[model samples]
Target chain A: MTERTMTKADLVTSILLIVFSAAVFLISASMPTMAEQNRNPLAAPGIVPGFIGVVLFLLGLAMLIRSVRRGAPAFFAQDRGKPSEVDRSSWGRIALTVGLCLLYALLLGRVWFPLLTFLFVFVFVTAFEYDRKAPAAGQWKVPLFAAILAACTAASVYLVFQYLFLVNLP
Target chain B: MFEGLQLFGQAIVSTFTLRALFDALWSTQLGIIIGMLPGLTATMGVALLTTLTFHMAPNNAILILICMYIGAIYGGSRSAILLNIPGTPANAATTVDGYPLALQGKAGKAIGIATTGSFLGSIIGMLAMVVFTPLIGSVALSFQSFEFVWFSIFGIIICGNLTAPKDPLKGWIAGFLGLFVAMIGMEGIHAYVRFSFGSTNLSGGISLIPAMVGAFGFAEIISVMRVERYEVVKTKIDRVFPKLSEVFRYWKTIIRSGIIGTFIGAIPGVGEDIAAWVSYDVAKRGAKPEEREKFGKGSIEGLLASETGNNACVPGAIIPVLTLAIPGSAPAAVLLGAMLIHGVRPGPLIMIEFPTFIYEVVAMVLLATFMMFILGLSMVRPLVKVLQVPRQKLMPVIFILCVVGSFALQARLFDVGVMMVFGILGYTLREMDYPMAPLVLGIILGDILDKNLRRALILSDGNLAPFFTRPICLALFLLTMFIVLSRAKWFRALLAKIFRKNATA
Candidate 1:
């Protein structure tokens, strides 16, 4: 969003972050406080982070106040509509890709990693391809070539590291 | 100097052996390819390769890692020039003038200029590595753990200040955020958990490579995908190569950018990306009015400035890595990890413990730069032609490489998840005008700050005075504070008013 496009949304988000962070700090801060009262401060669950959390909370508070007062559009430039913009509609696809990757990691030992890795590469890359022009053979060819290369590379890596190098890999 | 020369000769002899130097050179070319490909990055290239080097000689392993570092940094310009999308963060500066030149149908010429710039810059950076490393070592030996603590903090602060000058507060905020992230999972000093929040993966803190890939690569891709049009440039095929006269005309720019790149490289914790941006900006500002107009519009001067500056930064970044065990850039950090794996600790004792290790590093960087120069220049014209390829088609190919790059990091799907999360985070932050560089600086240097800060405190017996009193520490502290404050409205207004009063008086 450009400065002209920026609404009250940013301020709301900043306030929410500040509040949530403070609450979390309070909970964590209690852990160290309880430990200190027990005379076992050394055994505190999160003393250092508790301290850090307090600072982070304060910074968030500052940002919250700053954003609300200045109004984001004045303080920060509106989003320049570059080709690199990411919005909400694409979250599901992103999530699906992440899910595929996690599946690959979880099944690494049981499944053939090379094949799955290929699928992951092929599907993700192809899914993001935006060329809507007439079918170009070479354009599709890059993915095919990449898939083949990835599969072959994965196999070589697996063979080298697994059998020859004798290292465990997920 | 004679001793240095002898050592350089000895290194030249030792580094050139078939298995040692050639491998380093060959592998560097592969690194360039990895970086040139839009979806792959130098960090991932190095990480994936480190596993392969696990059984190699430590020297060989380090050489390979550095080669990849050199290659990747140089390679990113290919994408930035050809596609208007930087292949690596380091190449982001290149895109400012590079893509514009391509659109003007001077893609080949632009690529050629960029190639020359990168080559000369890398050579300059390498020369800096060869010359100043020992000097840095001689002086750095005086430092103890306490000094390192301040140094680390200074590095983070300087990187933040330079990187996000538009919002110094945000830069520090992001830097501290990264440090806090490093604090997650486990604290380096004690057996205490800092911010795991109860997840097992959280306990491990964050994996540096995955985080880097996510933020730089995945986020960049997601942001790109969300855009309605990725085809930002369309240009006809043209020849690529800077003319001899063009080189002679900008001799000063090349020299200045190379020098800037080298010095920045020598600084601990800072990296090539920032060096490139700073150099480009300086060169643009340095140029005469007529020349400056050509800046974002794609003057060969701007392209050369950025390319030379960033490539030169490669060697500059290496100087601190070899001498002081501190990396100037993120890839160098990975290279440091590889060094540890290879049983080589690159600190003051390196000269005594492993004689000519510095020489070997120098020779390796020089050879890698040459290889990167040759290979990078050759790919320019061909790559520029790829810009004509439509977005729908190009995007698919990029997607494949993304998958390959992600899986290559660990062959585990888990890394993919890390990449996705970071990618989304990067995209969102980017969408929100939050600079990504500070986050990178944070993650890359987080461990350094955590470890050194505590060590400094321990060494000083919990005395914080040294952080202020030490000469280098004091300068860095003040600089950091100054940069932070300069971003405030009051500071700007005060400066303006003071200047006005001075002019009137």
Candidate 2:
């Protein structure tokens, strides 16, 4: 990242960390000490986390001070232009990858293991390799290759995990 | 010593069987392929394989993982030499001299020297591991809760300091964040859950394998997808073996680099990357004027030092894991986790409980090193083909493995979700320039820190005197303080001023 971008990111991160640490500290302080159960107060479940929360807060404060001193707030005033086509394409690809992964994860147990895996791999490869600039007639090869790879991968993974490793697939 | 040697002999003899050899061959080959692939790291490879080896005998499983570890660390140099891209972060230093050699049409020679250096380095590291693990284990047996509490903190501090040299504050934050993640599960002593938010899955806590696969595997998949593709540098191979005299000419550099690498690897949370860089820098400093001039311009000594240092670190990194249940590197942390899953606890008591196990580990490293050397030299062309596999085609398969690897441990879908969350968190942290080593170390050390700190407190009846007074505890505490303070600009300026005054005097 550029210096300006890093400054802004650090500023936002420090604030979030500060908030998170404070929440941790408050919640930890409210946890039961188990005194009535004859537990040593020093051994309370919240003790270590409470200490961590305090340290994290101090670290966050340091980051906050450093970013502010670096003029993080001033960077916010700079207007940014629209992303280039390459950047937009990269973002689209990332979004598509995440969406497919989420869909696969969500449908994992509900669907047949091999089938779901095969579909996920096939769709992912096809989506990435499908060149919109290319002629539509040329796209069949990419999907065909994807299909073979997906099928092989799905079969091997299922057999290995289930039969070889003795892991019961969901 | 004799008994140890005897056990080491026995371990070597037992591992010489056909089945073990087969396991060693295939696992090492897989490790090399994984390492040769950009965005696939030794840590990720070990973590993913841990799930696969779950059903095997403990010794066999550990043997396979060790092979993978050694092979992967060595395999990274292939890409570094051939494509100028360090397949793993550990091989980043190798690219300096390696790619230059490749560009000069000596890629085959570079790979040859690298493989030899890796073999020698592993041997040196293995020797060090044999000598040091028992020594460290014996010393660690005397440690109490007070010492352990400080030790864990020291590990986190030093790890953060080294991993994020540009900005250690972010490193510390990542480490502490990992510690907090570990807090979600039930307290080890009282079984009281904190930060679970009333979820049963949360109370069981984040499993290490899932979190690791997500952070290293899934996050890598995403990161790899974001980058543009790289082209392979095609160089003809006239020679694949370095002359013995050529290798032995830099014997001093090899030994020096090996020692430096092993020492750096023994440092908690530090890994092969730093080891390689430090060895490279040291070798350059120690080289003659003419040789030094060729440091990054395809110097044989530089490549040898870097390759050896990193390979040595693989064994060096395992030392602390065997002795203190603390990982010397990220990959070692996963190995530690695997050991735990296999019901072989590695800590201060390892020497007493499984005295021969250390020897067994040594044998495994030895076997893996031989396999790495053999496969590295013999299969250069075939391994080069692995680098040509398109990321778009390969990444989806990797993602599928990540999903399966995460879920295979417990067959719980919740773990898969944990993997996703950690993957995003890991990617974001990477983008922000935060180091993941300290974060992973923090997760591994969390339980030890939490349980020990509380136990120390209770023993002292809330008095903090023993924490300050005990020799080891005091040493660790002071070291941690020194590291933290040394990072401060004011402290550095003050030290610089003092040095200037002293020089004048």
Candidate 3:
């Protein structure tokens, strides 16, 4: 099948880039043009960023033109006639994973690292286990095996990084 | 040259200890495992290893890091061949012919060929490093602000051009974005905070290791998770070594790719991924029509070119780091940082100051390549099993590792947060087809570019003429412009017309 024309995502990404470039340009402009430490205006902290801003703006404009010429669809419109399996489930998976990561990050330094890691891995594996093909034995075996594997992973990582390598863990 | 040889001999002696040998073997094995797993890359492998090796002796630590870097780059071909999912970006070209070979039930032979290609490519690169580094170091001594500025720009431009073949503009954009990201901290010239907005954390700027982990590691995890299921190929194993005749037949391709890979690797800020692609493209272009049909369909020559080019790049990427204090790739940048941390400075005066260090690095690379070859051939069966691990189970572990890696760099939770932010950003950018190589290179090169440009201008007393007038500067400027503009439709069309006319005559 032929690829779809520019989708709404392309247009949105281009516009976001344009806005980002403009923001960088403004921030660069606000930096000290001539510093007391150096007499040359060319040595200003803002010079390179200013140039990068201009390049980014031009690039964003190019992207905008290309996306427009290719016929951008609406923001919420689907790219294909029917949504595929990934299209239907990817968002939920992403959100759930992100949420798990957020919790892990929050708990990283507060609790014992190995313990926190074990819990995080356990939850993550359990959540993803349902999606895998079932073993021939029984449904209960999946979570039990996942928990054991998660514990081993966490303990191994802790031992390797903390004891062997002496990397101070958070 | 005599001094270099003396130092090389000393380096070989230093690395002969049982402890050193064990470090090299263990690190290389770990590197290969990381490289064979989907969602992990050579850059991340080196970065993570750097933190862990902080306490070892400089020689041992550096040996392990070098081994890991080489092994990881070589190891990536396994998954690329077996599952069509490149363990690292550098292996993407391998997937073209390698996966096809696996589908034809020659996976063992493909892996064996890849191993030989990596060994020969690395041998060539190591030889080049030994011979050319002193010469480059001497030449680089004269490189001033103008040359450095142009060099950094040239790196970014060429990298963007190579990575995003279809749309270089997007590549350039991603690169500049990375430069902007680098600008969000205290300026080196005056120590004046530019974009910190009074936040103490922002003043130190974003950490490179964390940002890189986010871009390549976490970003990969997110991308891999987005795909629900991937097609897996099953194949029977035969011999794990290619015939001597097969190796001899492809000697020309291997040598050509080695030369190309080393040359590209010597260029600052470029990496193995581009080397592989460029070598593959050149090989494809030069192939006879009948032989060309075998390309992308299990051609041994195509796989050899790609594997050789990328493997050679590991040592090529080290040339600038040792001679010029400039990194040839993202991993090289991290290696540069690690060297500084280990109190070994790599620059023009390295021969004068730390004369034996370069030779030590050369020895390390040589040892690493041998280890990689041995491990690659022997561990082929077990390593291929990594491809069978379900992505669902593998990704979360990868994600947790990303978290630990980012935090382990400086013991900063904020860096972990930075990784998360970049992970989301990288995922979005990847979805939109923007390449990540230039972005990472831009970040790595930003400070060098910024400092050199201003320094050149200041030295010239606000005159911009020297930037374009100096011989090296002029050449670099023209080369960068040529590479950037050569991708334009008009330029290609015009070149095509000229070539067609010449053919007709």
Best by lDDT: 2
lDDT score, candidate 3, position B365: 91
Once superposed on the true structure, which residue ranges of model 1 sit more than 4 Å away at CA? A4-51, A72-115, A118-169, B103-105, B197-205, B227-241, B267-270, B296-298, B323-325, B347-355, B379-424, B455-462, B496-505
For candidate 1 chain A, the 10 contiguous residues with the lowest summed lDDT are A33-42
True contacts preserved, each candidate?
Answer: 0.16, 0.75, 0.71
Q: Residue-wise lDDT of candidate 1 within B259-279, one digit each (tens)?
A: 999888777556788889989
lDDT of 3 by residue, A8-96 (tens): 55677789989988988898888886756556777888888888898899888987887776777542355557555345578877777
lDDT of 2 by residue, B332-391 (tens): 999999999999999999999998899899999999999999999997887788888999
Task: Please estimate how well model 2 matches the true structure, expressed as its whole-model Cα lDDT.
Answer: 0.92
Highest-scoring model, TM-score: 2
Candidate 2 collision pairs: none
User: Could you tell me the TM-score of candidate 2?
Assistant: 0.98
lDDT for each candidate structure: 0.70, 0.92, 0.84
Off by over 4 Å in 3: A1-7, A34-39, A73-86, A131-137, A159-168, B230-232, B287-290, B489-505
Better of 2 and 3 by lDDT: 2
What TM-score does chain B alone reach in each candidate, compared with the true chain B?
0.85, 0.99, 0.93
